[model samples]
Target chain A: MTNRTDFPPPNANQQAFPPPAAGNQVNAQNIQDALEKAVAPKVINTSNNKNDGLNKCPRCGSTEISTQPGTGMLVCHHCRYVFEVAVAVFKDPKELIGEAIGTGAGDITIDETQVTIKCQGCGAEVVVNIEGSMTSRCHWCRQVLSLENQMPNGAVPDVLLPFLLSRETAKQHIEAFAKKRTFYANSHFKREFTTENIIGVYLPYMVVDANVHCDIRGKAGDVVRKYTVGSGDNKKTYYDIDLYDIGRDFDLAIDNLTVEASTDKLNVNNKMNTNNIINSILPFDLENAVHYNGNYLKGFNSERRDTNINDLRGLVDAQVRDVARFKANSTATKYDGGIKWESQDMDTKGSQWLSAYLPVWLYSYMQVKGNGQKLLHYIAVNARTGETMGSVPVSIGRLLFVSSLIEVGLLFLVIIFFLFLVF
Target chain B: MEALFAQLLDSVDLTQVLAVFASSDEDGVGAVLLLLLGGPAFFMFTYMRYRNTDKRHRHEIETPAEMNNLQQYNNFIKHLTRQSSSTITGANDNVVSGSLLSNGGASKSFKAINDITKNFK
Candidate 1:
């Protein structure tokens, strides 16, 4: 597909970017360079920084350094300089031998983050890389991107989904989702939940890996309840509970745990920016996730994941606690009244970090808020599995009407049953 | 204050409550009779039968939401195919949601990676 000139040039990774922010922009040569990088070059040459999105040719200063064939690398236009871009090292948790149980028990060490890259904006080196992959922004000048010598394929992802469910289908999904709420939805949402306003987008997320080993010690109880008829009218009730001490150790490996990387409305702080319907649209098949080359995201809207590993530690923590809690509960269920969890001790073993791109087919809206806030509703499908999740506009009148009908129906049922008993 | 004590005493033993009824001491003793006879019996029966009922429900609920035998089989096959080829590796069995959904004897249509390519090359 021919690249659009009207839009900004693509990145070497093929991950799409929002239009350039404010004043920061890259030259035409950068776009050309990025486009050239999609298919690798036969000979290693580093001559110019052609019109690529964010890549540069180190040799003869030509921004047009094409990628080496079969390998997504930068080749010089004048001199044959072959440099392999460092990809993220993926370690699946299920493959690991031992899993840690809780948090803070491990000797944690991070790769020194002093690695810096040239900022297309300030022409200075900026630091990046927590796990892998240079970001969309230049650290020094905070520029959106400088496609000086970027190859187009660099902006493509290993896996991508073209939009499914036209705006009409998306609108329908949103409307259905909103029908139940009696209150707390935006006023304009009901009226504006139409198909005409939908836009397709690709959001970024991080799938994390960690081997968890938990040593849990807790109390579980089986509750037996019975009633004894007393002499005369005396009645007594007692709950017989059997309690015990429990300890267990199990290794758990979580694969593809996710945290959003996009800075859009569906961010950590603003769940409303994107519709929550996406949560119900579970289980996009990630098994088909190919390697990240970044060329597929051409005309669509895409955003980088703003949340980092540190930011998503809470998600991981919650997951570990859940496992521990489930384990405790399952053991306690051997008796009754469910188990009362008195205390828990957990630890984290070894964590493996991977950056993978998951596929989504989204149709959504962005509504401006009171103080320049934006709220959005989405009808999204897991492009790989067609698992649809969506939110629609709910009309107050419709909700009240439906609620009254439900109430009336319930009242009718109660009356019918009452009459049945009476008759 | 008197009401609280009466309730407390009522909770502890039923003989006195029954004695009060036999004696016809209170005007609203009628309400107490119905509750004393009705509520406890219902609760006891439910508690006694909880295990069998709970097990039955758990077993029945796991059945896929929408499918006859043939349709469910087809859906399962389709799901497996999508999983094999789709880029959505996360859409595997691990996730509870979006696993299987069928309607009226037909299998759910899942999106899958139609084309195959190696990792981000």
Candidate 2:
């Protein structure tokens, strides 16, 4: 392999391209040959055609396929045969080279909402709205038909993490959270809060694995002498610090860094909505994500991936830089005073992108203030890890009144002590 | 017994104690001001606690297990001396702190990783 630094610089007087020779003057044949030599971007094909059109039980061949509660497996209603989608295998982060993207992570060039599938049971055609739902039941034969293939509109993803936490368990988690904050909660929110409104949802996320090389240069200081001078109000402390130049270079392999793909959920405006509450429950168990199967989404609602890989390049770059900075801290432990990073550079040697749906149980409430200003609050539970977090509207007036009372009580005690001292 | 208790109480001069508190000194005024500000402080504390419940788990980036091809360089540059009222105890003091000169928009917690590094160093 040739190192990039070993290459010689181009001469200033040299023509970028030699004047076209007699037969090579920009012709269609030359252009065609150049185009043929160009290499297309690498793609990791994750498409499975066996379960493409109509999904049926391998045993009894029933179309009634649904996920079993508390278990990450699909079950047929009639035959009761339990199975799961094939697990997706990806290359190790260190082995990743160049830019490889999963087929499902491709750009959404088409705005498609409706897809018609020919029912295998009664030979009837059914239209499944990809926007609203991916699975539909045929009216003529009553056989369930699902859209299993990856669509260009980003409705379907490469992998799906089935819900492991049941609705009942999620409700209990939300209830316990709300119970703790009931006292400071707004009056209207308290009155309307209910765990029954919680619904299981599959949120869109873009999972990335990258091979990165980082270099950081900074200045660090070490205290050589420390002493105190003067006394009373004039007391002062002084330090003689020795500064040093520090530099670190390392290679880091980052794995399974997930980012929200939907535009609505990515907008985490604290004032307008509690969307960040959803983002707080990160780091789902993406390693267990199965191959794309519509049966996993039978009873749950899902949000589609609106943003493509290009749209998320900025976010991925920033996050990768953060990870690099964090990795360099381990080797920089000798810098006692602290390191102020003057320059940080991270080069992405290779990266792979894949789209997936992660499960979450969400409960929301609208708190309307006396002035008619409203704020939406959310309580989200990670269906995989059961990690819960939420925002509750606070009753500012009530809280202030109680705090005032506490202050008055302290003042009364002070006055009583003074009186005792005087008498 | 009751008479003895009364005599013991009268032995101490309560007027002197009262005069000490009523002198209107800096310490006395400062104590009163701090007490008066307690209510507002409590209000703000409780408000932030209930409002930002989602920020409890601040660690969004997972720390990697290992780093490869590690290379380190450190060269002594010069010495700096400064005088101030603030006490400097150890290397972790405010005088010798680190920050990101570039990419200022990075999370404040990422900068805090420097503080964590100080523990091991």
Candidate 3:
């Protein structure tokens, strides 16, 4: 909350650059003024450039803009103005297909870790270290500078899904989730649990849309005779089935298959952190995602895509195969007895991989058991759909004790019934 | 042959059987009432028999109709699959990849591709 500066004397650029606009209708001059306010005030660099991640407020000339809580538009802190960024659409299906099956890795492949941007307010050069961060506070003027443009390092994605759940709403959801599991939850966990400690994060993911052609060959069965053999204690049931070769070929159009772009988050091995808890909250509204703007990530934590498209291609293919199998199996639900798929082949005719950031509010804990083993637990709420999921550590002894009491009570009732019947 | 026929007729004793019922005793009336009323036990047994018979008849009528409906649904799925084959032929030429790079402009052809692909799923 400190707004003090010791780097340099304040200049004209340090003053609120663009005065608030008089009315609602924004024009070319307003945007130019906003850009000038975001960059050096004296420099006139006008070249019709695209604003992929840079967000400047045309109304107030304030760079302290963030995604308005529970809304899709960005709000300027200085002027209380709301606005939206233009989303890019891929209209060509063929282009998607090529990129899906493309031999190249992906579109943006930069590996730079640092960049210097000149402060628009004071004409001061500010070096921003983006090693594990997306935004930095200006050292001289206390202005928040964010990654506002697309770069080669793949730090910025093509799309951004702003948070729809505010921090307060997320805290309430987390508390309610923990309250339900408190009966068998470890006492230590209950004592230490705090929803205020939650962090809002924008995790990286790749949204894939595919036009697939599937060919499935398998053997299915029909139950002809379902009869019991033997009698009483020796009785056993058997099924006599008739099997036949079945094949199906169909074209499928799939939209929005999300895969984790970070390697650490994708690792679901329970021996480590509760990584599966995050993966379980997936399936964001990729369809409604808007263009990327660093302003959306101003107040929250963010991660860059470390895993490449080629690295996660196998996972995507497996997901496509699973979906295709599910569709093919729909026709065979009539085989109530049982059906087995011997083989299936899915050919990807077209697929498009797009990069985006999805919002999540997460509260994580490390639950250490009596056996000296440590386990991580997380309760996460999806920012867009408000879907929540978590793993709560429970006391095994407590559960066993409750179950045993119920079993003893049932046994006592059985004894009383037998005694009454004999009398 | 006449003596043999007489012997067979005498063994019947029709008058002896009539004397036992026509004596007008109380036991004879009771026996007649038992045969006429048939008792609650006998009625219950007969009612259960009819109910079981009706249940078997209803089951016999329903089994075949359920089997026929399942078979009809199976046939419908096959028909749908067959009809979809024709639509697959014209899809190859329309196959194209969508791009975020060209998102700034509104291309009618791209919108057409998106519309067509969305319809298939």
* Maximum-DockQ candidate: 2
Interface RMSD of 1: 23.5
- At residue A267, candidate 3 shows an lDDT of 54
Candidate 1 achieves a global lDDT of 0.38
Question: Which stretches of model 3 miss by more than 4 angstroms?
Answer: A1-54, A92-95, A100-112, A224-230, A240-242, A410-423, B1-121
Interface RMSD values, listed in order for every candidate: 23.5, 13.7, 31.4
Q: Fnat of the models, one by one? A: 0.00, 0.33, 0.00
Give the Cα error of residue B76 in candidate 1, in Å.
43
Compared with the true structure, all predictions reach lDDT values of 0.38, 0.69, 0.56
Docking class of 2: incorrect
List DockQ, one per candidate, in order. Answer: 0.02, 0.15, 0.01
Q: Write down the worst ten-residue block by lDDT for model 2 chain A.
A: A1-10
**Which pairs in model 2 have colliding backbones?**
none
What's each prediction's clash count? 114, 0, 17
| TM-score per candidate, chains pooled | 0.45, 0.78, 0.64
Candidate 1: residue A352 Cα off by (Å): 2.0
Q: For residues A1-423, what per-residue lDDT tens digits would candidate 1 score against the true structure?
A: 112223222236542224443442447875465345423222211213233235444555543343343232445555787754443333456443222211111112432423445655568765543223324465555443332222222222223233334444445554554454325244676555554545445655544445554444434443433434354444433444444444444444555444443334222111233333453444444444443432223233454344334444554454445444553344334534333344444544345433334445565656564456454556665544445554443333444454456556555666676688789
Positional deviation of residue A100's Cα in model 1 after best superposition, in angstroms: 16
lDDT tens digits by residue: candidate 3, A1-423: 111112221234553112222432447885565445333212111112443323469897877888888886899989999888765555344222323321112444777788777666666777777766677777788777776566656677767789999999999998987887777676788899998789998888877767665656555555555665666555544565554445555555666677777867765444334565676566677667876667888778888777776566655565566566655555566554444555555655456666778899999888776656676778889999888777676654565466556556555666676688789
Better of 2 and 3 by DockQ: 2
lDDT of 2 by residue, A1-423 (tens): 111122121237643223333542557774454344322447777768644457888899888999898997899999899998777889888765567788888999888889988888888888888776789999998889998778788988888799999999999999998898888778888888888878888999998888776767767776777786676555556777777766666667788888788888766555556676787788787779888888888988888899988667665665666667756655656555666677776766567889999999999888776657677888999999999988888887798789899889778877886798799
